[model samples]
Target chain A: MDNKLSEICKQLDQLALDILKLCEEQVKCRVKLEEAMKPGFVHIAKSRYIMGNRTVCSLQLPTEDSAEFDALTTVVPQESITDSEHRGFKLVETPKGQDTSGKSVLRRRKEKPESDASTEAKEENVKTYVDPIKWFGVLVPQNLKMAQNCFQSVLPLVVECANVQGELQRVQMKYQKLLKEKELLS
Target chain B: MAIHSAIKGKLISVIGDEDTCVGFLLGGVGEINKNRQPNFLVVDKHTSVGEIEECFKRFVKRDDIDIILINQNIAEMVRHCIESHTQPIPAVLEIPSKDHPYDASKDSILRRAKGMFNPEDMK
Candidate 1:
């Protein structure tokens, strides 16, 4: 009887260890899956910041009034447009008649009203004007996803931990009850 | 499911009875209101509306608080406070109380969905 009781105790200890290991493995697997799904960056327009691997200002060209400046340019500025242009800020005339360049081919293809020449010239002027500075930041989708998953993954673990804790409490209580019963019988 | 990095170390304490606040507290998410000024507060059925409102006012004033979770029943009493808080931090959430059922009409989720689906009806 003593040998059998010792064997059962060893088996129970092994089972507990296995359960804990399994729980850890499950958490690890879930974390890997969650890491793959994270977004590159959380762009907060209100804060004018991109939060990802690190917090960075969303503006490509860093400027004091970047938000306000970006807001002003509804049309794509010509100076800012980088294709195969004048490498480091060069004044280039807007192709007025027909642009052979593949980069501007799509824009040139669009039909414009003959009456809108003045408007077109005005737009071109706005594009050609150079402001020289750009603010931008690299956003890591993995970091964003990892952050999100961190919160989501906690819920199940918490529930499982609670359940296991409750079970352990019940098991202890039952063991105590059985010991009392044995005492009473003896 | 943002990582809630802002509120992680800071206390997001909950106040009230076992049934109402325990679930969130046990989940290891929000802080429990233990009479101390918490970054986030969760008020339950046992917590009075006046107490909740007073705490909420304090929470809104504090820069640290990011969110507040209050029992929907208790929130009904302090509707003015809930409506008036324009600050981004200390966003008030009306959750279901233990005794009272979660009413879709009062809940923000349902309200937002309704607004999205039937915007014209709202007018």
Candidate 2:
């Protein structure tokens, strides 16, 4: 009977360890999902600009307020210029090391000589300097949803891990008690 | 658990002795796979810092990798590369090796936590 009890206790200990391992595994999975979802926080810094069908949302760093917009102009890549009338926009690369502050600076290259009559050649050249807008900052809704799902999915696993840890503690206490009893009996 | 997922599908490129890498491998702690996601990579001690840094630069650019685990000793060698990374992805975690056990006094996380909880005690 004593031998049978010892075997049963051993089995219980193994079961507890297995449960603990499973719980740990679940917790790990949850954490990884959380890390992947971190970029979704960029939504907190979102800025939106709409031009026809192109609705651009920008995430301003440090803070999301429009007040911080000036600071972001330096950081964002300059791809194109937009005019106040929302027309005559031209694609030009911003000069390197040029500071974007106070008055806007405009440097237009000398007009090239046109040899042949082409529709592209007839286009007007307007020198306008608009602040470079940061385009990548928009909070991706899909990423945010995925992050939420990951957080929810990990909750059960965390509970299981806790339960297993609790069971292990109980078994450890019982094992100690049994050892003491055996010592007294001997 | 947070540590595990932060490193999932990400490569943990280590540069140290064989024993240290083996110890971690035996512990079954690195490179956990989940829900059809690709298994995280663990570069053993044999890899070089340059190779690791190059991989790190590329890894951070990718959406797949979230965390990077490196032996602290090896990380120290390429501190500039590690510090200069702009992307928040592939968060770098420095771990102790078999030869060098983790010293709380030297760990930045512990130092930061201590500063937050017991500001006076730090002095």
Candidate 3:
């Protein structure tokens, strides 16, 4: 009983440390976010201009338990760069969080096969990707970009916080169970 | 959950004051589905507790939403609803808004974790 209790105690201690570290990260992210927003207030204070109904980027959800969380990946239109007949939005995964090498991976997700096979069917499969930043204005100030970067950085941190919180909850339950067993044994 | 495979990617939904939504949306986390349903809710002084609860419940029900980032103050307003959520998927994260800073003492998950530590044990 004493051995089990000690083990639970160790786990609890580790979790406590992890939570503290996560809190520190959260604070730093919050500060950065606040700093990032400072510029937006001066440049894009018009509530109507900033408000938009659509999102151009989507988070690549973790598929497996061990999968690394990803930041929102936005597909930029290559209309100006290329006049290619096939105007499919290229999905590029930005290098953030664990991707320390800082190389953006140009990868595309497999699209669902269409039922009707027509030449126009190819166009139907293509999604028009709009840059979310454009929602603000054509000529947005650098502050808006900074705010986006700050918020983008917070995604992985939020995921880590959630994972640690889950672990702490599990260990807390185990500790409680062990305590009950120890009392009964005594 | 199997449907997650067919979908391209998941979304991080937001439920907070106007500033929080605007800031994060600029980060490119906002999305309106084919159903014309937005993944975020902008709460103002006119926004009621019931409205917040309703939007939160809606976010919880959304399969495409993997994370819900709500302002800590708004989360407190809907604490009962937040507590009832037990699933690990679609994590409900209480973040600090510009107006109200984050208070760890009021966080549901952090508060529960804190309870596990007894002062006597430290000694």
Candidate 4:
């Protein structure tokens, strides 16, 4: 009897997890669309433009306090703030050496191109970087990072979905038990 | 009931082709438990039926896995074992692979479920 009850519970548990997975997928799609609608969220064409033989990669300014249509010129090589004033638009400097969890989903450039090397070195610790290959070039870094944050932030939504699934399963199990009990009684 | 506690640690196991296994692994469902055992099995062209059967048996016996997702096509290869498995926990689900989409007609569970009711029950 206990075995049968537990088996039912186990099925319920599996269904609950499936509910959570589906809810997460739906939330991701909707959140990505809404996030994309925000100002400075969309990357302009100027960033990846090629000039002459050299492909000049222009990084966007940190959009926190930027006006509409605020953009950037090419980043200074040594990353001196002095060059900011000389350049037409402000260049939000990429942080040199800090690894911020859940933010700045920046890939290590050609300097650390061996993909596994940096990850392996950090393997000893609880590494928080999402597997790079998962979303490497799919969404731009800013959009991807924002989507990740939104996903984590809305975990409660997934939890709620799981709770509802659990309740529904419990009701189902009880209904089955009642039917079985009635059969035995008769 | 106490045995259920031992099985409550949630993890997803997989028995699938390269594309299916790689897709789930990339989704961050892959894990190597403390015993250095992976929760996934990648079935390649060189993989034998015996090896696939052994891995399926091992995954079914595992306490941590709450779900075992098998590519529907590969599940067809081990239909006997799948048909015999009655446990509701470690629920085995059939998923579509890149090369092969799911066919409801070939699903063992669905076939078994259909057998449970009388012709009158359908009405």
Candidate 5:
């Protein structure tokens, strides 16, 4: 019981640190974004039509990581506990040396069995990657491009922040459960 | 049908003021699904709280969206709706707008995390 409580405490401490780092990164990203925006506002304000009514970007959800990085919870069996009794569970993450490359998180083409004509058409639609800036008129100002770059770079950070927040929540729930159990035992 | 969508990637949606929407959309996270629904909403003073809540709820229910970015000040108005969502897939990130700076204390996820530990221990 004591060991379990201490483990929970340690996990909480690590998650606290992760949140702090994420917050700092967010601040930095905001600064870069504002810098990118500062030079463009005057131009963008004048040409309001550049803010088109429709979006040209396509949706491509990142593929889930393999089983190891999957956020699924698994019960960690304790020898002393019977199968019917409640047992502790832990959320597994990729161990060291198996870090996921954020760039590679983009979804791969879907595999499907179809006629030759349909397959070719689907492949054409999926394979073509259009530059989103083209949605705006050609020869947009440099600041708008800079803002786009800033947002693209910050995309990975946003994903990382979300992952950390989810993990923190999971760990916090576990910590609360252990606290309850410790009280019952005492 | 399930197999088709399962293999496809997800999208990042945005609900923010005009500047924030235009900036991120320019970054290429925008999309209009098969249903002719655009993935973003550009909020202004004319936008109602009810409309914002509805858009947020729609985004939460969509299978394609992986992330939802809302301007922090706009999120302040719809705090209850954002807090009610607990799913891990469609992450709700409150971002800074041109007019309002990011406030950690007002952020739902950040504040929850801050509450978990004492300030001294974090150091």
Candidate 6:
């Protein structure tokens, strides 16, 4: 049919586009890989970049030339040390001399060891508020209702697919029967 | 048993010589889609390697097809694509045809499995 032909043409067009994209991607990746495998790249593969083990490809190793190198020191310059100190917060002066005591000791009133009433209140709150089992029971019914609704929505589509599969099985049976008949006739 | 049940919902696609194709089709592996493209491709001497490669690519992309069986020789024509395919689902299998016997050394999947077992291959 014309519809079938057109559909095939459309599929062919899509397939062609997919193949084009895949080939382009393959070429891009391959070119990138080839570029990386070249002599100058990080991994200097001996097989591709060399002829003989005795003969070195690059006369000099990648190490920095001593001619370009100079001796270095661990000594911190006085100016840099001063710069480091300056980078920190401006030192705050104590509010107009209440007490300039070097040791401004902080001491608190010893905490109330525990009021039995507060302890009992905490125990009561724990017992009343945080019964996990009770919370689970409350949420279960609502979750079950949601799950049932979800299953109800999905069931029709599942049934339709099953029906189509059953139809396909019937067609397959018929095809098998025809083949059997042909075998007998032959 | 699991594979049997799984395959019942999914179709097997084939690409092979005419005789090989006919044998599988008779075994009830052949299917035509709504768009009128067959799940099986029959490759004759006249069939180009490019066409075989295209059909192989199409079969790999089809979600409905779960397994692909190609003639070992025919598979060689599209070896690059087959080796590149890493997905376990829609597994690609190379089978021998009348003209060409199966070569264990050349089969990519078999070679991969062998490599897995060989300790030196790990290096």
Best by DockQ: 3
Which is the better candidate, 2 or 3, if ranked by DockQ?
A: 3
Write model 2 residue lDDT over B5-56, tens digit each, in one string.
2222223222333333322222122222222221123345466777767755
Give the runs in model 3 whose Cα sits over 4 Å from its true position: A1-125, A180-186, B1-7, B118-123
Question: Model 6 lDDT vs. the true structure?
Answer: 0.43
TM-score of each: 0.31, 0.27, 0.63, 0.44, 0.63, 0.37
Sort the predicted structures by lDDT, highest score first: 3, 5, 4, 6, 1, 2
**Candidate 5: C-alpha lDDT:** 0.58
Instruction: Write model 5 residue lDDT over A1-186, tens digit each, in one string.
Output: 787766656665665556567656655655554555554444444444464433221222111221112111111212224455322222221222322323224434444465598766764454223344554656765645766666655555555555555555555565556555645644
lDDT, candidate 2, equals 0.36
Task: Output the better candidate (1/6) by DockQ.
Answer: 1
Query: Which one wins by TM-score: 2 or 3?
Result: 3
TM-score of 2: 0.27
User: What's the alpha carbon RMSD for model 6?
Assistant: 32.5
Tens digits of per-residue lDDT, candidate 3, B24-122, equal 776666665545577788888888999999999999998877678898999999999998987665668788777787776787876765676677655
Error in Å for residue B110 of model 2: 7.0
Colliding pairs, model 4: none
List model 6 lDDT by residue over B38-70, tens digit each: 677778778998998888888889886656777
Interface RMSD of 2: 20.8
Model 1 chain B is weakest, by summed lDDT over 10 consecutive residues, at B1-10
Docking class of 2: incorrect
Q: What DockQ, on C-alphas, does every prediction get?
A: 0.03, 0.02, 0.27, 0.05, 0.21, 0.02
- Report lDDT (CA) for all predictions: 0.38, 0.36, 0.59, 0.46, 0.58, 0.43
Model 1, A60-154: lDDT tens digits are: 22223222211111111112254632111111122232222232445568776674888877644332112211122234334333433343343
For all the models shown, what interface RMSD does each have? 21.6, 20.8, 10.3, 18.3, 11.9, 32.7
**lDDT value for candidate 4?**
0.46
